[model samples]
Target: MLDVLVVGGGYVGLSAAVAIMQAAPHLAIEVIEAAPEEAWKKDPRASAIIAAATKMLDVFGLWDRIEPDAQPITRMIVTDSKTSDPVRPVFLTFDGAVEDGRPFAHMIPNVSMVAALRDACAERGITIHHGLRATGFRDTGPSAELTLSDGRVMASRLVVACDGVRSKLRDLAGIKTVTWQYGQSGIVTTVEHERPHEGVAEEHFLPAGPFAILPLKGNRSSLVWTERTEDADRLVASDDLLFEAELERRFGHKLGTIRATPDRRAFPLGLTLARAFIAPRLALAGDAAHGIHPISGQGLNLGFKDVAALAETVVEADRLGLDIGSVNVLERYQIWRRFDTFRMGVTTDVLNRLFSNDVTPIRVLRDFGLGVVDRIPGLKNYFIREAAGSSGQNRPRLLGGQSI
Candidate 1:
């Protein structure tokens, strides 16, 4: 039996495998992905890698391969309404660096992130079964037996689920998740720009939702335009030129003319949180455990946190010759991560609700709160430090820039 069998080969799963292998190179590890080989080939969307998450990648030696292609965010500006709002002007502005003198976040293409993780796993001799799908599983004496879609059986001491929001493994394990669809959808696309973003990110809170312009490699920017579901469907179905026109209208001329990338897509928004993080010999991580609206851009960052905490807890337990899959060991991870996850989930949900409407009272109150936080240097610094990700337990060797 292998030491660990990881379900889902997304960012979180690979990160977990890397951590386990780094901690004990001889530990047998296998990752199963339902997609055919090269399933993530050329995924066009871009993702934000917060400083804390990048540091974890650095520990795993995966950041060096991805850093060259990443776009740093040197500053962030949040606006109450339009770019030219007259009252409650700039809701908030933050320098990109959180603490330890580093940029707060970096933006990289989804495919590039996947490529880096895949390369790292291959370099370490971690077997990734991409084409094989997980069908069912049963709990054996000291292991979990996983059945594949093609009639193959694999056994491991533990099964870690890092699948997406709709996790099949989580379902087979009977782990319930609370989920609700936001009446909104986010339209994401990249654009070539005339002026340099100067590593500055901007979020314009429109009545529909948040319109984020995140800096990207070279003179490009990634756009996350939120809208009501019905309106978003119509907008995405329109002709490219028509869509571009609407985009330009919402996205002001501060950056000169805007040109859309050839591809664009929209996804329905939602919030999902699992009822429990551990069950018997099973553990949950990444989107399987929690999913939140992207308005705050904290989705993947939270997943990285889960990877670090879970990996550290399991490694520590293994080092002590304890059962890594025991309820006690897994609950340690849950205890460390649940509060942080719940806080972020609540924050994003509240932000999404407060900003997705045109109510004058909320608009005024939120804008005022932003101003208050901005004016209080101590409070602002705390917020900034927290955003940079330095205040947490089970921090990995890489999170602090130490080699694992």
Candidate 2:
């Protein structure tokens, strides 16, 4: 019997396994992934890893491998304007460190981050079964039995679901969710430019949604360009010339002849917050627990936070000779994360609704608010720290690079 069975071998699942192994290596850990072997190699998108998340990776011995491919966000500028505006004046600018001279976040290629985590898991002797889908699971008092799509059953003391926003395991566990779709979609793609970005990130709040230009390792930038769902579908399916023309309209000439990289994709935006983070001997992590808009680029960081908290909670429980999967034990992890997740979900929902529109009065108010925030250095620094994942009263052990 496996001590821990994690469904979904994405970054969050792998991180959860790694954290458990780091804290309690004696316990057996295995991850079941629905995708075929090496499928993660094809993810072309990049993610913003906040300072706290980076430290967690460092503790896991994966940051060194990831840092080489990461582009630090040394500065961030936020602007509000119409998509057709010829000029966009920056309303808020944050430039500096979160702590110890480290930038608040770093843009890391998804493939690089996954590869690092995979290598670390390999080093730790963690088993990952690819092409295995968790069809269902049930609590059997002391342990849970998981059913695979191939008619096989595996027993484990606990099951952690990181299967993503549409988690089948979560449904099988009978956990409910609060979900709503935004009428927008985020068009993600990489762009090669003649000019360097100088490690600066920009968020242009256009009428449709926020268009973010995040610096990459080279003379390139990753774009999280948002648009109405219908418009996004058309733009993504358009010819290269047409797409580039539309892209350049908002991208401007500042990047000096920008062209979209071949890796282009669009993801529908939505908010899906799990009503309960835990069920019996089961726990939820990553997208299985919550999904928020990309307006703040905190989706992955939120998952990392889950990884840290759940791992710490389990390890501490085990250290005290308690059943790691007991409702009482699992509730600790849920309590630590539920409110935080709810808070962020609401924050993103409100921000998306507030910014993804053309309401004149609301725009005026928001822009004025941004301007005021820009002038206040203390408040700006506070927000920077918050984005860095350093604002909470209690910092998790893994988040601070400390072992449980």
Candidate 3:
């Protein structure tokens, strides 16, 4: 019998397994993933790894490997404008470092992160079964008996659902969620530019949604271009030249000549909040627990936070000879994470609704608010620290670069 079984071998699930083994090496762990091996490496997108998340990677002994490929965000600028505006004035500009030397965030390629996590998990002797899915799971008091799609069963003290926003395991566990679509889609792609970005990130809040330009390691940038669903589909379906033309109108000539790279993909935007973070003999992590708008760029970091909290909870419980999967034990993890998750979900929802529109008065109010925040150094620094994940209490040891 496995001590722990994690469904969905994405970064979150892989990290969860690694965290548990690192803290409690005697425990057996296995991750079941529906996708074949190496399929995740094809993801072309990049993610903004916040400072706290980097600390977790450092704890996992993967940061040293990831840092070389990570592009530190040294500065950030936010602007509000119409898609057709002749000029967009920056309403807020932020220094990307929370401290004197450390950057608040880094833009890391998805493939690099996934590879590092996978390698570390392999070194830790955690097993990952590829092209396998958890069809269902039943609590058997002492353990959860998980049914695979192939009809095989595995018993583990706990089962973690990291199967993403549409988690089938979460459904099978009968956990309900609060979800709604945003009517928008985020078009993710990379673009090569004539000039270097010098480690600056830019967010242009157009009428449709926020268009973000995140610096990459080289003279390239990753674009998270959001638009209304219908328009986003047409733009993505258009020819390369047409796409580049549309991209340039908003991208401007700031980075000199820019051309979009291949593998242009669009992901629909939405919010999904699991009503309960835990069930009997089961726990939820990553998108299985909550999914929020990308306006704050905190989706992946939120998952890392979950990995930290839940790993610590389970490890501590096991050390005390408590059943790690019992409702009593899982409640500690739930109480630690649920409020933070709810707060972030509401924050992103409000921000998206406020920014992704053309309401004149609201735009004026928000732009003014941005300007106020920009001028107040104390307030700006507070926000920078918040984004760095330094202000919260009871943060898991791993999140602060300490082992459990």
Candidate 2 wrong stretches, greater than 4 Å? none
Give the alpha-carbon lDDT of every model: 0.86, 0.93, 0.93
Which tens-of-lDDT digit does each residue in 1-404 have in candidate 1?
88889999988898888888888787898899988787798678899988888888888777888999999999989887843454425768898887767798999898889898889889899999977777897887688888998899998888999988998888888889888999999999998989999999989898999999999988899999999999999998999899888898777777898899888888999999998888888899999999999988889888888888888888888989988888888899989888888889889999999988878999899889988988888887777667777766556555666654
Q: List the residue pairs that clash in candidate 1.
A: none
TM-score of each: 0.96, 0.99, 0.99
- TM-score, candidate 3, is 0.99
lDDT of 3 by residue, 236-281 (tens): 9999999999999999998899989978988999999999999999
Q: With candidate 2 superimposed using the best TM-score fit, by how many Å does residue 231's alpha carbon deviate from the native?
A: 0.6
Worst 10 residues of 2 by lDDT: 395-404
Regions more than 4 Å wrong, model 3: none
Flag regions of model 1 displaced more than 4 Å: 82-88, 393-397
Worst 10 residues of 3 by lDDT: 93-102
Sequence-dependent TM-score of model 1: 0.96
Backbone clashes for every candidate come to 0, 0, 0
Give the range where candidate 1 is weakest over 10 consecutive residues by summed lDDT.
Answer: 82-91
